[model samples]
Target: MALATCATVAGGMADFLVARAMGRMGGGARLPPRVRDMCARLGRPLRERTFSCVLVLRLLPVGSAMMLSIAAGLAGARAAGFIAATLLGSLPQTVVFVLVGGGTEVNHQWQVALAVVLFVISGLGGVWLLRASRIARADRTT
Candidate 1:
């Protein structure tokens, strides 16, 4: 758990630094049109709800963490808020992975089962969060 926490914090900081540099360098101009469009869409919510958006994105296992970091940077999120949210959101999966990995070495079936259950719940929560964010975005636009 300690190692995971440290790694997550380091990784989040690294991502933020890289993305912040890229944003300063006008990196978005080099992106393809489709990616730019996607970024624009993603950026809006991040701008509106910096911490929650970062937390939700981090919780979702589907997207690339680097991409999210870049998007948050481009959207002008503060480093402190972004990093804090990333660490908080990353705890669930980190715990699950640690438990499952340790459990496998000990051949603990219950531990593995609990990890799977946690993973499923996280996925569901991510889906719900995405849907809610989208709805809120639409309402704001209208």
Candidate 2:
């Protein structure tokens, strides 16, 4: 249990930090003029949204964090927001994975349950976040 928890938290934090560094180092800030203008209007709130999206992407598959970090940078989110979002979004999955650590059975039903729960929550959350982002972008346009 402890091992799983540690792995999850460490993995999430690592993903966040790695993404932030890569984003900055890669000059991801060199976005198009339109995006730059949009970001100028976004002010600080953009940072929070970027963090949420990046963290969500990180919790998925391996190497996903790299791509998401780049996306966040290009999208204009700050490092602190990225890290916070990664940690906040990853907490639930980390807990679930840790809870499932005790199962030893190959045919364990609990494992399936855990996977399903994770999938549902992740999918729902992703949709909600995306919608919110779209709304935010639209608001900035007007």
Candidate 3:
């Protein structure tokens, strides 16, 4: 458990550092004016709530870890805040997965059952999702 947590945090920090370096070096790219304006507007909120946003993103299994790290770095997040939020946020999912995967290969019945149940739930939920295109169409009609 401790080992898993440490490894996860270490990996996250490493990614964050590399992305941050890229962000620092890439700051001078000559983006178009319209795109640059949009980016500045969107990046404002991220800078304001760096820790909370990163922590929330970390908690979810969204699988865009590199992107988030890069964004955070680009947004000029403090190293301490990024690392702390990452450490705390990595706890729940890591522990759950470690526990689920800790079992021996021969006794994998429960793990399979749990995976199927979760998959079914997610599939069913996706069926009724309110898409952005639908919302935009409805708003335009109104």
Candidate 4:
């Protein structure tokens, strides 16, 4: 179990790093034209509140850091800025997951509670990001 936990955590970190790097490289440019067009249409709103929304989303585990990085990059934020913000915002929650996984289970309730909290937080962050993405796409159009 411990080994699995460690591997999972390490894999998560690696995936996040890979995503961030790819995002910085402009992953969005490779998107289908239709998707790009949609994003472009709603780019304006995202531009208006990109920083706050991105920061919050990055802090939540609902979205992966790499995915977030791609989003921020596609939204017109600087790659370095987005990467830095994502790292900072995600550190706490990522630590929580890693720490939790390091130990064995005593009671299932605690695990359930943690899962619930993470789910709630991630859900809220997702809504915020969705709104922000729409805004960002709109901004690009104008």
Candidate 5:
């Protein structure tokens, strides 16, 4: 479990570094106009609330991890805050993954069910957080 957690963090950190570098090199110019617009919309909130935005993005399974990292980097998020949020937000999914992986070996139905439940809860929470962030951003603009 500790190894898995460490590996996940390392991978996330690497993704962040790559994105940050790309951002520094005008990566947005390579993206499609639509994607650039979406990134701009998302980027504002991410810039204002770096930690929470990263945490919510990590929790939500909808978007590409690499894209999120890129958007965050382009938004000028601090590395320490981004990494910390990624680590903290990844805990729920990590727990679910560990539980499901171990349960599969033992063929435990209940454990699998619990893992599913946790996954559902995490998804719902991610949605809620995203919505709240959007609303907060709207409020701030008004």
Candidate 6:
């Protein structure tokens, strides 16, 4: 659990920092000027609420980890916020993995059941967050 949570957090932070530096150097070089401008405008709120945004995204488990890390960095998320969110958000998933990996045959059923419950909850919450984010984005655009 410690390895999964802490080590992975370190990896994510590294990815984030590297991506951020890359973003600073020339992240939008290939994008058309119009698209770059639009991305900058849309990234405002994410930059403002970096912790909450990153935390929710880390918890969701829907996208590529590399992409999320890159996006967070490119959007100029705070270092502390990104680290804290990644650490906290990885806990539940680490719990499920630890339980499954260590449990005995007799103990495994309940652990598996708990894992399923957690997964279902995560899925539903991801859907809710996605809808809310879309609505918020729409409202902002309008």
Highest-TM-score candidate: 1
Best-to-worst order by lDDT is 5, 1, 6, 3, 2, 4
Per-residue alpha-carbon lDDT of candidate 2 for residues 1-142, written as tens digits (9 for 90 to 100): 5565556556645654654575568643665665445434443444555665555454543344434444455455766766676666666666565546644468777875886687577767766665655534644564
**What would the per-residue lDDT of candidate 1 be over residues 42-124, giving only the tens digit for each residue?**
77777667787888877887777777777777767777788888888888888889889889766698888998888888878
- Give per-residue lDDT, candidate 2, residue 65: 44
Clashing pairs in 3: none
lDDT measured at residue 13 in model 2 versus the true structure, 0 to 100: 56
User: Runs in model 6 with CA error above 4 Å?
Assistant: 27-42, 103-107, 129-142
- Cα error of candidate 6 at position 76, Å: 0.9
lDDT of each: 0.77, 0.56, 0.60, 0.54, 0.77, 0.70
Give the C-alpha lDDT of model 5. 0.77
Predicted structure 3, TM vs. truth: 0.62
> All candidates' TM-scores?
0.84, 0.51, 0.62, 0.47, 0.83, 0.76
Record all residue pairs in model 1 with backbone atoms less than 3 Å apart, i.e. clashing. none
Model 1 superposed RMSD (Cα)? 2.5
| Cα error of candidate 4 at position 130, Å | 8.2
Q: After superposition, how far is residue 119 of candidate 2 from its true place, in Å?
A: 2.0
Which digits, one per residue and each the tens of the lDDT, describe model 5 over residues 17-126? 77668778887688778657656777777777778888987787667766667677777777888888888888888888998998886659887899899888888999
Query: TM-score-based ranking, best first?
Result: 1, 5, 6, 3, 2, 4
Q: What would the per-residue lDDT of candidate 3 be over residues 29-53, giving only the tens digit for each residue?
A: 4545654443354354446656666
- Supply the global lDDT for candidate 6: 0.70
What TM-score quantifies how close candidate 6 is to the native fold? 0.76
lDDT of 3 at 67: 59
Model 1, residue 120: distance off in Å is: 0.8
Clashes of 4: 17
Model 4 stretches astray by more than 4 angstroms: 1-29, 33-50, 60-64, 105-142
What is the C-alpha lDDT profile of model 6 across 70-128, one tens digit per residue?
Answer: 66777787889888878877677677777777665774688888876876676677667
Better of 2 and 4 by lDDT: 2
Per-residue lDDT, model 1, residue 2, is 88
